[model samples]
Target chain A: MDAPTEHLPNVAEALARAVDTRASRERDLLGELEALGAERERLRVAILSLEAQRAALDPIEAEVRAELTSLDDGAHEVLFNSLIAQRAAVAARAELVAEAARAQRDAARETTDNIDALLVEYRQFRDVIEPTLPDLPATYRSVLKAHHDGVVSRLRQFFSRVGADPVPLDAPALDLDVVIGVDGDGAEAVGVTIAIPVSGDVRAATLEGAPELELTLAARVVQAIYEGLDAIGQPTAVTAFGDHRGLLVVEVEVEPTDRADLVDQLLGIMEDVLGTSAELLAAGVRVRALEVPADHLFPPEESSDTLEDAS
Target chain B: MSEVAPEELIVVPLAVAAERLQIDPFEFMRLLVMMGEVPATLQISEALIDRVRAAAGIELWWAEDVLLPTDASPSRAIVRAALRQLLERGFVGARATRIDNLWRGRPEDEALLRRAVSLLHREGMVGMSRSRAGVVVSVSPAAVPQLDAAVRGESMPAALAALA
Candidate 1:
């Protein structure tokens, strides 16, 4: 009794019991776990049902939120359409205003252009242009155009006899474009112009298309005009020569005390020329006088055809 | 002595040489001219002048100094002076300008010189080569003997016959 020989005192049975107890506890725990799982499953199913409900209501709530955030029927969009139509109308009016502005600008430009033209013309007037003109009065000297022909020598003699001291051309042999005025001091004259058709052709130096003898007669006609200037003695004549289109032109200046007597003097001179240059007229040399003033200023009319017929 | 003939030789006027030597050309030429006719051609060269200068046994019969006549007209005096210049400078030839300027201190003197030169030219004493600028006056080679004789105080029929 004191010490039992077998030490295995019901340990298997106790282990079996403990095992049964643990199995029972395990079964209970399993059952409780199953219960908890069922409860969790029910909770998950309820949560899914609530989630389904929330999913079902989300679109309606979203519709309400959107309704609060924005307008219904979009009246402001109608306002945008109206603004677009108003923009079109403003553009058309601006186009019309722009057209008017362009027209006004064009008109202003034309007016300015005319004003500028008038200013230029005014600047070109004699009052403005006269100061710049040379103070050199006409001289009783000959202004030879280029090279005068040999007839110039004879003409020079004739001019000298008629009180026209013709200045000699320095290089009469040159064929230049220069019109040389040679003066032996005190040759300048403040007198009236007596333009001479010094040359029948424009070329004085070459006497183009003019015979020497014919040229002699033409120059003599110029000399014959002075016979009628009986009282205008000792008046120096300044001779200027030029070439018009196919015609020789010369201008001379003479002084007269009375401008009123110029018409009579010119008429007398014309008569004298017509009488004196009868040979020239007979030779069919168109000895018509032009650029002569009648009283104030005479027009260059072609009336001297009678002289040719008379000849 | 030159092998070159007188014509081939460079002809320098005796006046040029006399002007260089500052001696009477006519007077010295007399020393060279012999009794014969003046050679048809004479060479005027530096060698000949040197020889003439160095030569010995040469008789030069030149005019002695004499007084100008109290009654000597200006033209006559000009003629005498031209002759003297001709002799003194051996001036056998000169441009007319030179003869003209020679006595042309005054206008009258120039006229006188021109008249004298013309007189000499007309007398056949001088030959002239006319040009646009002026005439050239040269002593006639044939007249050299007579000019020399006149220089030696011989009576000449020319206007300047009494040159000496």
Candidate 2:
């Protein structure tokens, strides 16, 4: 028996998780930015201190100059030379301080640029994955649009859904067999079942409006449908139709919750997956509600042992 | 944005992870996915993912059996699927197609074209047909190995391995 537990969290939970993750990342970025700013300030303070020392030396140089002029000619020359030497030393020290400040500022700018790059990457990643966000990052949306548009073109060129007109494709054509169904309660949600056929040259085959085909051809059709749907997060069931041609029809069924939007989403995903230039002209594929009725939904009663006995 | 401590933000590069595991970056990523070390919804092509996993040191991908280097170049979809599996296993952080261009094909590579089509058929990942333009491969989750022997290959003990 399955243990009873709470159901999975809904869209709200998903949104909350996204928000929390973004918040944490933003905080980290902010911290790095602050550190960079502080380092720049410290460098500026050191530059100011050097300037103060240079200012204090100016008056001392003037007083020494008067004393030098008052001494004997040889003694006066020595005093003047010493004072000039002291001024030169102070100038060199100031230059070193200024160089240090310039280096620090450059380093701080680099640190800020790195942080900006990281933040940009994070933002792009967020836009691609989060569905609830009002808009996606520009690059992501562009890629999706190009892919989606291509898929739509392909869908229109080949297959027709219920009540929709089929667009023409100049290439050799084949139509896949699919079983459509909905759960009991007349749900608008529908599913499709497809059978795989044993053998055929699909490239050479012409559209015959047949519901079944040889074993190989059937398999190829099912494989195509499966690939198309899986790309869009929609899946179908494939099963053997009968032993006559080793035929199998692929089936895809959606549940009640997504029933309303499933077809549109499926169509969109299929077009994207095909990456074709053909347009999808039809809105829906007219499926008989009775063909694969919900009443036929059964328990697993057909035994392999029973089949073996019959064979 | 609030301030975060320096220790809170850490970057893990693919090359660095590959080196740490003593394998190619791809192979290590596969091991991570199979181990369920990351989110399950992450999507990537299987061929690239398998290559990455193999590069990272995880040998014995299913694609190894069905298609050879001679048959066709594995498709980007296969690589993406492998990446998705890796993400689920927590071997890598995440996969974004825009960020991961390593597995994408270059022009004029016919071998990659054939191998990808064949792999797509065998794995049932995508239902794309070969055309004059090329083919599109389906991306799906990597199959989890059911036995320790299957995973450990010839050189290592299965018991030492971790399963997510």
Candidate 3:
């Protein structure tokens, strides 16, 4: 029995944010925009306050000096004490105003520090939300695509190990399609299957009207790819068939990465085991790339045994 | 179809009967149908072992002689049938083309036969002769041992030992 995808929260709506990478990017842009607005406002207010303090510094100093000088100039036996007291009061009020402004600047600095920490968390929030979001078709598609590429990369490494060069292919163009399936009662996709299509052609005879021959060839190709994959320590479940047009289609259980290059490598193995292209053509076996039915691509792992090898 | 083996008969399918007799499956099908061994529907190709035991000079497949112990390919079986047909009739043997004409598109058995013939010839199990017979193929002297191993599904080294 398969495990339900309940652990993947909001799975049906998984790609609500993750799928549209543009949306997450837009969110990042919004965050940066907000940070910019806040910092700008902070700097603007701080700058205005600094200007106000600088402007008030001169006036306060002049007022204190003028009052003190008057008290000094008016020093007399009876008035001296009262005038000096008034001077001390004026100086204390000016110092209190300056100290309050300094405290306001310290408070502004602390707020900026808090905002800085918030911006760090906002970026991390983007990171945290992505994987926790439910998985959707696009998630599988992208991962399968990577897995497909990894298979090609692995194949290339395999060839390089032998100091041999394979017939280069635009491997990304090779199909490793992920098929999303929704259960009968489930509202969204719950399962996936991987498809890898291969083309089979015969130079001498047509397999179009010959279902048995097509199936035979299809079986051979499947055996070839299966062995190739196993040789690389990448054994996987597979189902393959030949179509009415005598083309071959393969489905494999989903994996973290693909061994898709086995399809390409298989032609080489077949050519070696069977013969050269001309010899193969004479024997009515031609391997190439082609399309397959989307409807048939995603059979379950057990399906390979059920295809009924009529050959 | 008058001959009968001395051994007890066992239940098996017509195809297995054909395999056991070293005869082509289609030819065996025809032989069984003609002798009223196969039903009209043709869906049921199963019959008693006695039906096949009734067809040949020898004690037939499972009778006190060696019967091939493994599942042989249809093509290999066809090749054997061709040899048996010539031996029964006391002929030198027939041309590959003659077999092709008789078997074309009948389940694509001709293609299989062609590959089989090529492989057998390459392995020196089929001989070519000229002159009085005027260019025809006959089973090589080594064919029996080689084909014995062939039908038994022997491994390459053991099969090589058989030829050696």
Evaluated with TM-score, which candidate comes out highest? 2
Q: Ten consecutive residues with minimal summed lDDT in candidate 3 chain A? A: A173-182
| Pick by TM-score: 2 or 3, better one | 2
- How many clashing residue pairs are found in candidate 1? 8
Worst lDDT run of 10 residues, candidate 1 chain B, spans B34-43
Candidate 3 residue pairs in backbone clash: A147-A258
A best-first ranking of the candidates according to their lDDT comes to: 1, 3, 2
Candidate with maximal lDDT: 1
Chain B TM-score by candidate, in order shown: 0.42, 0.21, 0.33
Q: What is the C-alpha lDDT profile of model 1 across B1-164, one tens digit per residue?
A: 23432222323334444333333333224324321112222224544554554441122222244333332354554455455555555546552223433443333455555666676678888766532222345576666777666444454436653332
Instruction: Single out the weakest 10-residue window by summed lDDT for candidate 3 chain B.
Output: B1-10
- Global CA lDDT computed for model 1: 0.40
Task: Summing lDDT over every window of 10 consecutive residues in candidate 1 chain A, give the lowest-scoring window.
Answer: A174-183
The fraction of reference interface contacts (C-alpha pairs within 8 A across chains A and B) present in each candidate is 0.00, 0.00, 0.00
Of the pair 1 and 2, which is ahead by TM-score?
A: 2
